[model samples]
Target: MNLFVVKLSLCFLLFSKITFGQETLEYKLNIGDNLIITQVATQEIVQNMNGSKHEMLNNLECDFNLIVTAKTDSSYVINFSFKRLKIKTMSNIYGELMNVDTSTELKEGNFEAKMFAGLTNSVLKMEMLKTGKIVKITGTEAMIKKMVNKTGIEDEFTKELMFEAIKKEYGNESLSRSFEQMTYCYPEKKVSVGDQWTNNFSGNLIAKNTWTLKEINKSIILSGKSNISMNSQEESYVMKLKGTQETEIIANKKSGFPELITVTSNTQGTSITDQMGKLEIPTTIKSKTIYKTKKYVQ
Candidate 1:
């Protein structure tokens, strides 16, 4: 009876260690650390209008870099810049709509090329907390000006119009909101395997995300599920959508930066257009996105 009791206690101790071991996860980077992240995304959109189905395809690929320039006890100041940008779009109705690659020489009169090229030269400065929250972002005004100048539009009014249009998507507020979806995944407290937490993202897309720590080994594995809603309006149309997204991430244990991340989402809703006499056209979109990151040395 004594032997049995001792063995049972030993088993309980082992089980507790395996189940409740906690680890702190946060960004741990030093000044001069450079991280290069490449993202690839593919999207398919289907719309039913006037009893006909139309489909569009979009493919996007880009490389961005983050360099830690300064660090405080609680936060890091980083510089973010786009290294390359490429986009391709096609539709059943329009065939090939636009293709732009910043790596290649731009065509003289290609507006899309001129517009996207500007991103490669612009840098955004951000102050990010060690807990993965972005507290402040600057340089959007200069970035927008550079983008507009790349277009070579001589009229000040045209440049102003372009600047405002671009600001909706690339302004300081917009960038902070968009980047939070990636940077705001960490919890304030320590976590063990199988622990779960919740966060949120808001912008053109609003998502409530639930994340789980699946495993901790050579690399940490995390998974997430998000319930998303989107609302977008332009001069002539408005889009409303609801969807679900699934995400998987492999993150470096030391730096807390993602090594690889993948996400899949499906959304469906309606498009209301003035041209359609306020008709509600059924629309659906499916997308897959992948991000790969590595520390750059040199």
Candidate 2:
């Protein structure tokens, strides 16, 4: 009887150890690793402008690749390039505003197509820590130059203007902050299942996020909630919004690369525009985004 009780206690202890083990969730990437990532986002925007309701629907699909170029003891150098981009937008006020596909032949004099075509063949260099912190990103200036040149504008003044305009959205700082949302999800120390951590993102959109490790199996399941604020400015308009977002991620166990991610958010605020004598319009936006990643090693 005593031997049977001792064996039962040993089994319970082993089960407890397996269920409560701590894990270091850092990227374990190797050189020559390639990751193909696809992102799809859909947004619905509603605005009350001059006592009239206006609605717009926008869908964006993008494909990009990341290659591990060099690895240090603590960091990795990666090359990132866009493979394709597609956008479709519809507005109740303007009907179909844009429909562009970079994978297909670009139509002559199509401004949207010409603008997005610049993203192809341009590579950006990124330095990231094993802990998933993006240290620095380079090559945005060259990318902006390529994009402006692809527009085929003749006048230098016009090109300069276009360069500045594109820089607002695709600048080095902007890209770094935008990509950090994907990479900056790891804890500084090891954690076990049910453990939670916090991270923050700053850019045009700011988010204070809380991440929880929900499950640890063949793949890790993580869930996140964020309080988001948006403050963006353009030549003609300034937008301020506040909202919350929920995110779910399923990641590869070995490499810590996310296999799938989904995010949903809703924001409400006002857009102040200078186009017509400084009007402040009430606006709301609901968005859903999904990311899928595939890995290849050569």
Q: For candidate 1, list the clashing residue pairs, or say none.
A: none
Off by over 4 Å in 2: 1-20
Candidate 1 vs. true structure, TM-score: 0.92
Window of ten residues with lowest summed lDDT in model 1: 289-298
For model 1, residues 1-298, the per-residue Cα lDDT tens digits are 6999999999999988865798887888889989999999999999998788889999999998999999999889999998899999999998989999999999998898998899895889999988778887899989888889999899999999999999988899888887777777788888898899988888898999999999989988999999999999988999999999999989888888888999899999999999989999999999999999956542
Clashes of 2: 0
C-alpha lDDT of residue 92 in model 2:
99
Error of 1 at 2 (Å): 17
Indicate the worst ten consecutive residues by lDDT in candidate 2: 289-298
Q: Give every collision pair in model 2.
A: none
List candidate 1 stretches off by more than 4 Å: 1-20
